[model samples]
Target: AKIIHEELATALGPNTPSYQTVARWAKRFREGSEDVNDDFRSGRPVSVLTDENIELVRQVINNDPYSIYDDIIAETSLCRGTIEQIIHNYLKMKKVTSRWIPRQLNDEQKQERVRLCRENLAKFRDGFWRLCNIITDDETWIYHRQIHHKSTNKTWIGEGASPRTIVRRSKFEPKNLFSMFFKSNGPVLIHAVDNNETIDHDYYIENCLKPVVKEIWKQRKSNGTKDIKLLHDNSSPHRHPHVINYLTEEGINIMPHPPYSPDLAPCDYWLNDYIKQNLTDQPDKKSLARAISKLIKNIPEEEFKKTFDKLLERLELCINNHGDYFEHLIK
Candidate 1:
């Protein structure tokens, strides 16, 4: 740009190219073309715009849109610029990063998800408020760490303002495992498992979950409710035959949940995020349990109700998407 301005000033005294003019010339110069004057080639007119080449390039890209420009050039026998133009202007395809799905579902898994969503949707449509009887649980690992403000979370500042440096949060400290159980009203159980213990079938059922289930059942029975629906993910411990027998004996109905579908779960979509956002530093298991219990009790009942409603929306979304991840449609 500076060189173009100098040349313009030298050729025509007191005349300067506008910024846009200089930018245009600079773009052309940067493309490795030094000759400012256009040169006409003597031969058949050079063209890659034939219908055959365009169709051929489109077919090649339709086979695999992730193909690079070089691949398209090899297949269509067209130049890099021509391939790029066809991809961008002709076919109108834009590259996008693949989003994170919990896990890719096979055909059977997808069918099962559709079936479960349909069943839940029917039940929900019959009695919308019946979702209040649902007792859902899930476990998550809480890291003893803090997050710094990232570049994506920054804001524009005025000139001369002090510059702020972003610091990366460390995660070398010990973490704790916690499980939560709740209805659309409040938490029924929030247990932080011992740091020394692994949450296998024996530990989860015998030590943590069964006692809470009995307590919750007693509480509900005293309040004139006999049956309650238990909704948890299809984790190994949760799906064990012994655990299922225990729940059956306790009179808790295990709700039908499709495998590999966390997006449809209230705990995954809302409660977990809520807990993580409100979580503060806690030193040990006792402190973590107390903090998590307090936070769970403090959450507004209306928030949980909204989560139940979101479940309906998500089921409909899943059906619409044919069992695909529906998290992107939350907003």
Candidate 2:
């Protein structure tokens, strides 16, 4: 940019753009931004767009990213328009809500997560890529009738226009509890619990695992059942004595998952979210059920396999974090 500015100065002395202009355009091109427009005018005096006021607003924002605009104005003694212009125009920043995590882990739990991740990573050190040989499963609630999100219906409404009416059908919406099991190749089983059914030890073994074992037997006919490990969470019914006994009797090995660490699980990280993307904001119950059934019927092989690769990568990241929640670090 400096070299370009020198060239421009030599060719066109009076009409050449300033060095600042040349450098700013160079940066915009490098960052892949092509818009050739200034920030929208806020109708405030241009005097408030000074270096000192911008710096003050920046300092307050940096101290607390979650600080409201009013709070920033109070702290910096700046007017509303001045702050808005600084934040939206000069800083090129926007406020976003914090993301949710499964649990608020203490130091000990974080260390334990790191330890378990290290143990898992050691298994992959032999270059076998053991995730393909593992079967992952988890339970989630599937709503029968999904409500439309306000974000979906946003539009440019006139000030005096009548407000859009959205009738609420029921305060308590109907939903089904589903337990799903799948390997890297494809899904094995998705069992919808009976109405008002409590998932206990007996129901888990008889209703869930028994059918899952049958599918596993057919899937892994070449190797013994012990070769395929079961990766699951530390849920109550999952960790029950009868469930453990049932798995043992079938010669199915159990994969050790750290308690409260959903970030390390394949379904929690990828599969559940994959389903939610397609099923959210559905207004019809029967259509929602049909969509759910179709989705479970054909799990994408390529995308499903990618989840395993990402799983191994996440395990390494877990070790790097010393067992803290590391999903926020991804990408």
Q: Score each candidate by Cα lDDT.
A: 0.80, 0.83
- Per-prediction TM-score to the true structure, in the order listed: 0.70, 0.71
Q: Which runs of model 2 end up more than 4 angstroms from their true locations?
A: 1-64, 78-94, 127-129, 148-171, 280-290
**Clashing pairs counted in every model:** 0, 0
- Among the numbered candidates, top lDDT falls to 2
